[model samples]
Target chain A: METLIFDLDAKPLREVNQFLHGDASGLNGKAFVIENPNGAHSIAVGLKSDIHVTVKGHAGYYAAGMNQIAKVTIEGSAGSGVAENMMSGMVHVKGFASNAAGATANGGLLVIDGDAGLRTAIALKGADVVVGGSVGSFSAFMAQAGNFVILGDAGEGLGDSIYEAKIFVRGKVKSLGADCEEKTMNPEDRKILADLLAKSGHAGVNPDSFKQYGSARTLYHFHVDNAGAY
Target chain B: MSEQQPKIPQTKPRFSATFDESTMSEIRRAAATGIYDIRGAGAKRKVPHFDDLLFLGASVSRYPLEGYREKCATDVVLGARFAKKPIHLKTPVTIAGMSFGSLSANAKEALGRGASAAGTSTTTGDGGMTQEERGHSSILVYQYLPSRYGMNPDDLRKADAIEVVIGQGAKPGGGGMLLGQKITKRVAKMRCLPEGIDQRSSCRHPDWTGPDDLEIKIAEIREITDWEKPIYVKIGATRPYFDVALAVKAGADVVVLDGMQGGTAATQEVFIEHVGIPILAAIRPAVQALQDLGMHRKVQLIVSGGIRNGADVAKALALGADAVAIGTAALIALGDNDPHLEEEYQKLGTTAGAYDDWHEGRDPAGITTQDPELMKRLDPVKAGHRLANYLAVMTMEAQVIARACGKSHLHNLEPEDLVALTLEASAMAKVPLAGTNWIPGVTGF
Candidate 1:
């Protein structure tokens, strides 16, 4: 297959993403490498396809926003709000992504290679996010239904205000939300994490070291006893 | 820097609308009808108007202090409940956050100098803290927005206060937009963007969301700053009850509410005129929420948006605001609303009273205008003095109103001392209407 490489040196995000995923006018079914993707916003936003993309540099907020079907990988530092409300396919980050990555995502797999800033996977409804590194404080906040896996140390106040979402962490967790608690890392979590890692091409991860973090199922609907925390 | 009002140029006559031949015909035709000229959809309904409220004078029961003589202090201590040491502000009137990238460095310097002279604090906007601002300001508040542009460790340590901005009043859920024109080379480098490119701010913070995460975030910031500076959480005036309660619980020392009229560096016109509740409607609910949580007055409340003068400050306090923040008015003091720049204003397709093209960066007075020539029109030192004078005047005005209400401090102005001239203001501000007690429409609310 013929591959198209984009120079990310000052190329407008809209212009670049337009050529990547905007129908036949874009690089349809062709592999593309984007280098020096510094501070570009919404790169490959709203993509729905079967093409492969690799970002070589840092990304700004809302990278791969509302992405679907296509595979997107970021290689450098990412600002807050990456891959927000994504529906399908896979979005991978090789470097640290800032807060609120995969926020309110419905479906799709978001894989981070490095540490994520605060508010990881906040309000996630139904997306599968796998972080290769640790997440900052408040991961999986108000999450409804999703699988969030953190490979590294989770920061303070993790899973705060969580809702029905399952989280897996390899390192120490600082805190848990009202409805969240440490859970049994059953075969399901292990299998899922392993599978996501394999799909995102990081087979080096050992799933057994990771523990399961999830909702405590106590403060889901706001009871009187749980009112103190809120 | 002394508390004395300077003589303003009164060159223009006390005349009303003076539209030229073509615009006058349209105005006349519109006025020919019995009804007022129709505007956007939101205008027709009985939303609260600011003109509806009036302050009651000092009565026999309450002793009014000397407006010009007595030292009714405008100084305040914020972050007392949470921080080990609270910040002692010189004046209750604070400068609202405006970014260096959005405003010129000279303008930012002026704000800092003016606020310092006036004994108030100036704030940084979405952009990171600049040395010029820090040098000029006696007390500086650094803003932490979702974008995290130019954010680093050094500036964070230097800041007197850290304001974690969740949203603004102008467009509550809306993000920051710096038009292409404003993104100069200096701005681009600071924000890590290409020069002259239109930039959009992120709506969500990079790290965490919700109070639980916010608590951790706050702790991190505190640790980074060695818990020296006070932390403030700024939210748009939406769901104040929940937001304030959450912010307080999340360890915010101060809660800032920005109302609908809050200024934006640049936003869609549709978003600005619409979105977010008014400051008037937001204060009471927030106060009630705080009181319910037993955190009332414990967590300081600073209100912003549509605040024009000292009267507005007095009213905001009476309605439960602990302090008032001004963005547009501060710019006005720095030569924003100068009628003297009327001729230059015409070329920009906006008159002195009607100009909202802050995003265009073509300000004639050098405050909002980003043009090199226009910016040269301003002298930072003189502008700073003007701003300082304005702050003192506002502070005095608040003191005068406080004394009339039999209160010593600005925060002592209570809800009972105020009466509303209109029904909407009565409902929004939680005050009784004058003449008769009935608040016109909100019988059920």
Candidate 2:
């Protein structure tokens, strides 16, 4: 495998991104190692190829944002909006992630080994997010369609104004938001959780330990009775 | 039988303030339908606009240029602040953002074609950029709205510029609403919403909270595009001074200020009429904000809403706007609400030139519907030619006014060359009254 090394301290963020931009489809089947990131923002943004990127140090805001068909691994903590609007790819964050981890993403798989900050999956359309640790408040706000799995406890007001997206949390929940409630996980959910756990490398966790949460569907249509909720 | 009847004094129609026909009809409709009336277009009520101000042609103090022989330049450059590639347009007037879903694909394509022909730019509205628009438009500005519907990074890269829409003038603080009938299968897929369901876009951005967050967001977008494209911040014409200042502070290369007369695909009528300030009132404050920041011309200001004809364009430019965008007028040029479609319009319980129910998707002009047959009726090539012709006429008309005012360039026409006809307009525009040397708030006692 061809490996490319980029030291952020030696080169500016734009220079490094320019190199990546120039390589577009040429980076396929190649690996890139970004060293001394120093919490640099917007690393690997708008990357579209099926390349493997490993950031050795912590990343600033929007790390690997708008990634498509690429495999990215963030070895340290990530700032806000990691993997935002990712179309089809896998982003593995080894440590904690700041707020809005996967905002408005369409399709992707994001696996966070540590805790995720508030509004983790806000407006997520169709992405599967698996968190090893707890997620902060307002997780999955206005989520339309996706599968969000949390291994640990969830913070307050989870899944507010949620739609068809399913939430499976293993630990205790603080509270649910408007029109969101706990639901029993049937066999189908267990199978999906099993698959997601295996993919996220958390197969040791018990699928049966999780509880499912979803939209109450009351606010789907406009009615005067539900006006207060809006 | 031939007795002369006493001719009673004819009682004139006395209009009521509280129980007017419009108010009564609105109450009746609301009571019957349980939901507020949602329609397209802008405020129907007349307000202060560019027409309130007129130019005094050069006679003795200033010398007029020869009409056809003299050069009257109209070129404008946008986003010179920080963008690597700024937009250079031949004309100061451009087509404003009107989405593919709200308008037909044909209409969007027509706008792109017309703008491209005129050497200007067209913009993508609430929905994302369509292939037809991208292909036809030589320079296209992609809007980053609060809804985030159809927002994708690839398109952001493809765009010549990015406009972060904070608020629309028609409904300043309100969100966008697309009714069930307009959301076709394609639109549904693009927006990630259910088919045939009412789609209400959120007014607030999911990621950011306030101005501070907006700064971060702008930085992020700049990073996404690698600072190759210019970033514009569009605000509704309310609190223009503060909003423009904040946008410039947030690292915007351009600012788009839209007045209440700006049109929308679907919005509450109450919000449209009572929400925002007029374009005439908004331009000066926005320009002042830029001037205060010491970046007036550095960061281009584009004003929209009720901009029609050459005089309106010249007035806006004289008030310190670098460019003026057109939405409602553009649609009209594209054959929306044409009188020739009177029969079809009447069948929809509305008449031509008064049809505002664009959300109903029964437009006879085939400009604002997703219905396949109706959409097919609008030929992009023909409509594009018509729009180009209209733009040409507007440009020539502005040239005539500029020549008469002794200004060689449109930007050379300053506030000193204009005078307001009414006190309200004089106060709002900060220009002298027509027959007096006094401005209402400035020199007048």
Candidate 3:
């Protein structure tokens, strides 16, 4: 496949995005590289082709947001909301990510090699997130459906008001929010954890060491007893 | 008979003013059910609304145009600020956002068809865009809500305009709640939740928060759609002045302000009635915010909530609103709360025009239910025609008022052409009281 290179210093981010949003039939199965990103916001966002994108440097907020059928890789740190609302494909962050990484994503694989900031995978919908390092508070606050695999420690209020989404943490959890509780890991949970770990390049990690967490099913229907939790 | 006729002092049976019958019943209901009362529709209590304001027709100082001879234009253009293609409508009245889960598919299609036939726009709500609405609506504004349910880039690109919902008028600080009964398989699958689960939509967007962050968020959307589709920011009427100004500051091409009278599918009754200000009190402050920013017409303002007729549209425009949106009224035109369904409503333990239990999914009108049998009762074509007729009547009525006020276009109507019947209305509408040059809030009139 021929590689296409675009320098952010020469061309505007808008031009790059517009080019990426061009006819998917012609642009699919191609490799593109973005140079001198300089933490620009909305880089490679809304991509809908089966193309590969590589960001050489740090990216700003919403990098590759609402992405579909595209593979995006950030070699350096990323700002907030990296790969937010991603529909399908993979987003690999080589370095630390700021707040709300992979927020509200419906379907995707987000691999963050370093620590993630607050509210990572918040309201996550059917996406799989793998974080190699620690995550900040309120991560997966209202996650609906998906799998969140954390190899490191989790901050306060992990999986608050979660629904159906499975959370696997290898390290200690500071606390669990309302309607969230630790659950016994079954064979299916183990398989899902192992698969995500392998795909995110954490193949050496043992799935058995991780503890699973999920919704308690108490807040599914409103009751007076759950008023305090609300 | 003589003994029974002995003198007795007659007294009338009186009830407590504070503890009215309605209030007592609500208290009893709450005691019986531990959960708070949840219902649909807007505030039932009366507030100072459009009826409180009157138009000042031309007589001596101003010249009035001939009714049938002169043309009173009602056309409006929205999102002219940044969008490559702005929306042009024949009439200034549009349909407000109503979710598919809250309303049946037939109802959604009818709204789209009616709005299209009338040459106006209709909006999608929290549950995300449905194919029925998109296929039927000539101009569809897709809502980018907090929940992000069924939100995708493809749909975003397909929309004529995008509205980022910050809050709703019925429950500003609160999130949306679709009870388990309404969470059918389709609704559940679209929302990515389990079937029969009561879905709770978040109050804030998951990705970003605050105005500064919102600016970047809007840019992301613009980049996604290539700046072709207009971007609107919608806010409930809590503090309209601040909210509208902030929405503009956040790079909104249009600002939609929904007042307290806006309807909700399901919300706490207390929150619906108590939270947010009335549209009558909200329009001026929102317009003032736009004027202060020097973006009055550049950034269009769409006001909604209790806008029932052409008079209300005229009043909203006179107070500086570019256009008006209707929700409850549109539902009414589609046959909600029709007296023809009175017998069925009685079986549901409520009377026609008093039925607001939309969350129960037992709608007699078939407009707010997911039941196949109930939904089949509503014919999209017929309901669409009814809505189109209503829209035509409203536009003509507003044209009549505008012609009487010596204005050739509905947008030309100014605050000087209106007066308030009560002090509250005078202060809220910022118009002078009838028979006197006194606006209660302003220093001088």
The lDDT leader among the candidates is: 3
Candidate 2 chain B worst ten-residue window by lDDT: B436-445
- Lowest lDDT 10-mer window, candidate 1 chain B? B36-45
Docking class of 2: medium
- Using DockQ as the yardstick, the better of models 1 and 3 is 3
Local distance difference test, candidate 3: 0.94
lDDT scores of the candidates, listed in order: 0.77, 0.89, 0.94
* Candidate 1 lDDT over residue span B1-445, tens digit each: 8899999978875544456564575468556743222111111123564567888768776678776676666778888876766788877789999998778888999999999998888999876888889999989998988766666445776788999999998778867867767778878667655466556576877556678767866765664454667899999988999999999989999999988877877775556666888888899899998899888888899998878788888888888878889988888889885899899789876588666677778877787645678778778899999999999888877787887777778887888788898777888877778765565454443
Q: Which ten residues in a row have the lowest lDDT in candidate 3 chain B?
A: B1-10
- The residue-by-residue lDDT of candidate 2 on B61-150, one tens digit each, is 999999979999999999878899999999999988888889999999999999999999999988798999999999999999877889
Compared with the true structure, what per-residue lDDT tens digits does model 2 show for residues A7-37? 8888888877767766666778889999999
Instruction: DockQ for every model, please.
Output: 0.05, 0.55, 0.88
TM-score of candidate 1 against the unseen true structure: 0.63
**Candidate numbers sorted by lDDT from highest down:** 3, 2, 1
Candidates' TM-scores?
A: 0.63, 0.95, 0.99
Whose DockQ is higher: candidate 1's or candidate 2's? 2
Error of 3 at A90 (Å): 0.9
